[model samples]
Target chain A: MNTPTPAHVDGNAAAGVLREVFAVDLTAAVGQCDNCGCAVVLAEARLYTRAPGMVGRCPGCQAILFRVVRGPDRTWLDLRGLRCIEVSLPDS
Target chain B: MGIVSPGFSGRRRTADLPPGQYLTDDFPVLSAGPTPRVRPEEWSFTITTETGREHRWTWREFRALPTERPTVDLHCVTRWSKLGTHWEGVSLDTLLAGVETTADHALAHSYGGYTTNMPLADLRDGKAWIAFRFDGEALAPEHGGPARLLVPHLYLWKSAKWVRGITLLTHDRPGFWESAGYHDYGDPWREQRYWGD
Candidate 1:
């Protein structure tokens, strides 16, 4: 994980109850940008929603990513750019 | 693809099946940022300027500061996280207009030295605020309850959660993630997820 440097603008950011960003050790990221096929490093980047069903740009090509919609008993990642991605880990 | 409806049951499922991350397609909703701890009476939100002027208010008064409920999308920095969630609170414009922003300005300041730059115009025209509630219910502690600033644009982290106070700055300062490596302008559409290309 890359250490994020403070841009150092102006003002003070208070510390909260959580000391570190997260205590949970994250596994090496295997996130592929769906668009451009770039690898998404969880340590260095983030994801957010821009619209419904249509996940906003992958940030690589400004391409909308995939999302998980409700399945009968569980939710599934509704891939739009391509077919289902094979996960290295077994299904949860 | 990263889009999810926090307003719907589907989002609940997505939120549950995750690495503790939000699920949504909207850059703003999925990236609504982490919710703050809710401290009803103990909570106090203040606005201070570089000149040493300050204004303080409690959760009670803060809740009454012209609340509005809007269902908007959220974007996250990780990738495609979106949610159409409803928020209620005083508009950032209304809050600023009522107070004195001085010639100096404030960057978005949050817990853990998490601060982001916010130009006057971005805070105007009802673009920002300190949200205290979601939907018609009080905001969850994780959702930055008690109060958290909401900036729909520039990714959700720019909208500091668990915001204790706003300090006027002479210049722009980046927050925790920004300092760590997140892009200064975290545009999900542009995929400006990290610092530097």
Candidate 2:
């Protein structure tokens, strides 16, 4: 049987939502997948927003990288799928 | 209620929205990965009970079963609620008819490995269906075509798109989103989007 491959955009598609929470741009931040330990920039993670929130999956392992849900009063950001995210800081 | 802003023109009335939810006219497509296109001939629906018994149906047999056109509201955990959406499908009750199972929880498995869990109670008594038609048209692939689980009472995520089968479990097991910190029982009214909420 033929199974069509699913399509998705990269984490760059989620920059707008991530910006609502973080002051700095997060698309360039490198996050390590908790499942596979593969690290990639947020912009390279697979992003899906067809549901109620944005779901970012690790391109290497396809495990959830992060999820963002925005409400009228609150925005829920779940990054348990990532072990750690490294964001570049500006040098003083 | 907050004061209306000066010269504010509302996009639409929000009188019927659930807490923390906004009304949306367009049905947004959301998925954890790429859409799966499963041909109807190759498609099958299965129900595996905790007892290890399995009930199966082909696309043709499934379509032959009694079908219903239901108009229901959908609330996504992301806080978007679409009201009065129409669909046609075989009810879970019809699908489960004559199938014996003592399980109280169900994990719906989708075509592309997407899964969601909910109480078996939520799948009964006309609360849910394996919907194949939306607004009088065959469900689109982007919107979970061929057929998708339609559980309007809970958040839309519970309605697994491209649904293929249901496993009746004696105890609840968190599926994809659930294991990733999403609420196990995603009730939009309670604002249960995350684990704590």
Best by TM-score: 2
CAPRI docking class of candidate 1: incorrect
TM-score of each predicted structure versus truth: 0.55, 0.74
Cα displacement (Å) at residue A90, model 1: 37
Looking only at chain B, model 1 earns a TM-score of 0.75
Over A1-60, each residue of candidate 1 has an lDDT whose tens digit, in order, gives 998997884433533313232233322334566558876443333344332222323445
Q: How high is the TM-score of chain A in each model? A: 0.35, 0.73
Instruction: Please state the error at residue B99 of candidate 2 in Å.
Output: 1.5
> Compared with the true structure, what per-residue lDDT tens digits does model 1 show for residues B115-196?
6666656677867778877777776666666677887765776777777787777766665445444566665556665555
Model 2 lDDT at residue B40: 96
List the lowest-lDDT window of 10 residues for candidate 1 chain B: B26-35
lDDT of 2 by residue, A2-89 (tens): 9887698789999976565477688988999999998889999989876656889889878888888665566668888899888776
CAPRI class of candidate 2: acceptable
Of the candidates shown, which would achieve the greatest DockQ relative to the real structure? 2
